[model samples]
Target: MEFMLDLAVSVVSLLVVGFYTWSLRGHFYSPKMATGAKLISAVVIATTLFFLYLAWYEHQVAWVQIVGLVIEICAAALFWWAVSASRKARLRFAFDPDHPDSIVTTGPYRYLRHPFYTSYLMFWSGWAIASSSTWAVVPVIAFVIIYVSAALGEEKKFSKSPLAPEYEAYRRKTGFLIPRFDQR
Candidate 1:
């Protein structure tokens, strides 16, 4: 039972990542970060990969792993939904200096301003937990910082876009990495 669950987790994660990565490459991505946030991103990616490899698959499926997997699945679903919704809205997935193709408010974007980063964090959390290594959380913390920085960077860029005013309003209502219910 645990083995099957493990396999399911691994396969689902790979498929979602592979599909998203491919889809994202089709758009014009910003070659730069809004404010040098790119520096930490490199460390984040390298550490994440190192920790993920350290958390080898086939570890005992403990409660923590199961919880992490559940979060990962849900985050992946949200990520997929947001991406599809954005594409449907013709919102190009780039971060160029120019204005964004559109300001997305549908799907996950309505709740979290950066669902992709949120999804990555959730996925990383799951993999780290499943590894059953207490030390895995260290890299995971770095992962969170990196994504949060990237999300903030996006907001900074958005602030300069044609949708600056609208984006500001949206930011008030949306959380950076998670859904915020403080606003109606």
Candidate 2:
């Protein structure tokens, strides 16, 4: 049972990496942006592979395995939804906040200011939970910090841009990384 669950987690991790890579096609980036983007992508890929490596030896409890799979799937769905919604927005990598010409407020963006980051958090948290190791949380923490930094950087760019007013309004209606039901 442990091995089977581990194998499943490994498969899911690979799919997540594949999906993310597929989503990046055709997006142009400047040299600086490309370097940052590559670093980000490398970190993500390494983290996902680390999860697979942990699965090879660490045995996860059945409940954690099941729950992790559920969270990963949900995160994947959210990612797809966000990507689909921003299909026409010409969304750039989060590393390049200044590259986006417009703010996306459709689909998942309508509710979450950073749905992509939220989904990433969910995915990483799910994997950490599945690993059933205390050390697994290190990567999760690192990713949380990274995502928050990226989101804040983007927010700073937005505040400095002409879209500040519109983004402020949108921010009021959306949550930073979670759904904000109590809109003012």
Task: List model 2 lDDT by residue over 70-151, tens digit each.
Answer: 8998999998888888777776776774635789988988889988889989988888888887888988998888889888
**lDDT of each model, Cα atoms only?**
0.66, 0.82
Off by over 4 Å in 1: 26-59, 88-101
Candidate 2 residues lying further than 4 Å off, grouped into runs, are 26-32, 97-99
Q: Which clashing pairs does model 2 show?
A: none
What residue pairs clash in candidate 1, if any at all?
none
lDDT of 1 by residue, 1-184 (tens): 6666656656665665565566545532555444444444455456546544554543555676677678778767877777676765543333334456568887788788887777778877876766667777787788777677656666887788888999999988989887886776
Worst 10 residues of 1 by lDDT: 89-98
Task: Please report the candidate that would top TM-score against the real structure.
Answer: 2
> By TM-score, how accurate is candidate 2?
0.91
